[model samples]
Target: MAHLELTGLCKAYGAICIADRMSLSVPEAQVLGIIGPNGAGKSSLFNMISGDVQPDAGTISISGRDTTGLPSRRLAKLGVGRTYQIPRPFGGMTVFENLLVAARFAGGLGASDARKKCGEVLEATELSHLTDETAGGLRLLDRKRLELSRALVTDPELLLLDEIAGGLTDAECISLVAFIGELNKAGITILWIEHVLHALIEVAHRVIAVNAGQILADGSAEDVMASKDVREIYLGSAEALA
Candidate 1:
């Protein structure tokens, strides 16, 4: 069964449609990348899958079970996890504390288990040295890592990543790509929305291009990026197709 599936999803606010009968299915353990222009409803799609936004129409299924309209907290317990484009850690809390909260709440771990999960997540994200540091004090790279850690602490079956590589240096992006690759290797099914084409290309097994609330292309990463429609809508110029 597909790890995640969306059928005929439709959403709109006023006259602006964010998702127009969109549908997709992602097989287990696959890394799928989504790309589009600004205001293309990429994040809106993620919101719906993560249960932050209810679709006006359609069904969402995880592991072949209906999960439409479920709340974010409920979705988390069902093994759905996500990271925002902008990292939203508790600024006043220590790194370990923030991870512990996700482990306990989202992961539904008991106190002792939550502590063990936090330690594992911290080590996995290479944030062990900063475990006692305030989340607000970390630099951009560390904050991004924390965002990933928080999502991973939930031990999700399907992970949604929204532009987690947006503001990193090339070296940092490479590091993150490596980490993400490792996560996928560990059997986490990932659906990533990223404007960093190279990073997405490195990790995603397949790619889909969305625009104006509909999918324009879906195929292998190279094929989708090379598609004329994707180039025109997302890259904005034929020069990128060259």
Candidate 2:
């Protein structure tokens, strides 16, 4: 069975439908990248899959278990980890402390185990040197790394990333892409919703475009980007995405 599956998922707010019978299946450890125009419902889709929003219909399953409508906290405990577009670290906490909390709560580890896991995550994210720094003091790139570290501390089977590379320098973006590639190689199933097209192309094995609450295209990264319809829909924003 696929590690993560969404079958005929639908979500509507009154007359406005945000997800229209969306369906997808991701094999274990696959890197799935989602791209589209501004109102593509990409973030909404992440929210639904991460259990932050309840779908009006259809099913979300992880490892053959129905997960639709489950709360976010429950999803976290079920081995689903996620990062937002805007990083939200605990402002007063130190870098290691932030991940330690996630390890203990989300992964159900005891204090010592949580600390060990936290150390591992900090190393993986290249934040070990800043373990004592306050989270609020991090720059944009480091903050993004912290977001990723927080998710990693959960030892998640599935990782949902929503525009984690939205604002970064070209060098920083490249580094982030390389790190994510390494993570995927280490067996983490990832679904990344990103406007950063170049970064996605570097990491994702498959690319999909979502528009107006539905998937518009799905295929190899090159093929999806070359599709005429995708081009027409996102003509002006190509540079930003790239």
* Top lDDT prediction, candidate number: 1
lDDT of 1 by residue, 1-242 (tens): 99999999999999999999999999999999999998999999999999999999999999999999999999999999898887898999999998999999989899999999899989878899999999999998788889889999999989999998998899988988998898899999999999999999998999999999999999999999888998888766788656
Report clash pairs, candidate 2.
197-241
lDDT of 2: 0.91
lDDT by residue (tens digit), candidate 2, 1-242: 99999999998888878899999999999999999987788889989999989999999999999999899999999999999887889989999999989998999999999999999889878899999999999998898889999999999989999888888789979888988898888899999988889899999999999888888889999999898778868775456556
Q: Give the poorly placed runs of model 2, Cα more than 4 Å off.
A: 236-242
- Root-mean-square deviation (CA) per prediction: 1.6, 2.9
Candidate 1 residue spans exceeding 4 A from truth: 237-242
In model 1, state the lDDT of residue 136.
95
Give the whole-model CA lDDT for all candidates, comma-separated: 0.93, 0.91
CA lDDT, candidate 2, residue 228: 73
